[model samples]
Target: MKALVIDDSRVMRKIVGGILVDAGFEVVEAENGQDALDRMAEHDDIGLCCIDWNMPIMTGFEFVVEVRKHAEWRDVTLMMVTTEGEQDQIVRALAAGAHEYVIKPFTPEVILDKLQFLGLVEIEETV
Candidate 1:
């Protein structure tokens, strides 16, 4: 699967993209919501998106809302990977169409676990 990682911070985008790349996904990076939308247009095979809430051009929440408006993008799973850890913020993001929420400072394992839960990725059984 291909995953788009959207964040204004270059370090954050690289961090999230690296995590997805490690999880067997082709990764793409976008600086903000508008950039993410542009990336989506450029890549039709994007199956997942990792979004950061606060950005310059467009917010991740706004992106989620905008994506939800497009029926064609329904198959794409949206996950908010941001530092907005407030309970209300999580609820709002979910209400806006985010499939999963991951507060920033998260470990790779946490991301993998969320992806597994969303059925976007599978885990192997240990003998």
Candidate 2:
């Protein structure tokens, strides 16, 4: 699977990318929502996008709204991985068309489970 992980923290991005890679996925990085959108626009092979709530250039909510407006990218599974634990923020993200939500301090197991549940990661046979 191919995933685009959008976050402001370099550490967070690397951590998430490592998790995805371990799960047998090719991951791409974006510093912010705008960068994510630009990457998405250029790569149609992207099957999933993991976004962060707060960003400098463009917020994740704004990016979600923008992506939701386009028909082509509607089928992409959008998941938010951030510290925005407020109920209203979760509601807004869901309303804007996010498929899954994962709060910060998440374990790699949590991320893997969500990806599997969302049909983003294909389970491979062990040797």
Candidate 3:
């Protein structure tokens, strides 16, 4: 599967992209919501999106709303990976069509677990 990692922080994008890549996903990095939309236009195979809440051009919430408006992108799973940890913020994102929510400062395992929960990845048991 293909995953888009959207964040204003280049380091954060790299970290998230690397984790997704390690989990067998082809990764694409976007600086913000607008960039993500642009990438999506170019790549119809994007199945997942990891978005940041706060960004310059467009907020993650806006992105979710825009994506949900398009039937063509309905199958794309949206995950918010941001520092906005408030309960209301989480609720808002979910209400806005985000499939999963993960606060910033998360470990790769957290992301992997969420992806597994979303059925975007299969979890393997260790011997």
Best of the candidates, lDDT? 3
TM-score of 2: 0.93
State which candidate, 2 or 3, has the greater lDDT: 3
What clash pairs does model 2 have? none
Q: What is the alpha-carbon lDDT for the whole of candidate 3?
A: 0.94
Candidate 3: deviation at residue 87, Å? 0.3
lDDT for 115 (candidate 2): 85
Model 1: CA > 4 A from native: 125-127
TM-score of each: 0.96, 0.93, 0.97
Q: Which consecutive 10 residues in model 1 have the weakest lDDT in total? A: 118-127
Per-residue lDDT tens digits for candidate 1, residues 1-127, read 8999999999998888888888899999999999999899899999999999999989999999998998889999999998899999999999889999999799988899899889888875546
Worst 10 residues of 3 by lDDT: 118-127
What RMSD value applies to candidate 1? 1.2
lDDT of each residue in 1-127, candidate 3, tens digit only: 8999999999999999999999999999898889999999999999999999999999888999999999999999999999999999999999999999999899999998999889989987657
| Candidate 2 colliding pairs, count | 0
lDDT of 2 by residue, 24-74 (tens): 889999999899999998888888889999999999989889999999987
Clashing pairs in 1: none
Clash count list over all predictions? 0, 0, 0
* Candidate 2: segments with Cα more than 4 A from true spot: 123-127
Ranking by lDDT: 3, 1, 2
Residue 118 lDDT in model 2?
Answer: 84
Candidate lDDT scores, in order, read 0.92, 0.91, 0.94
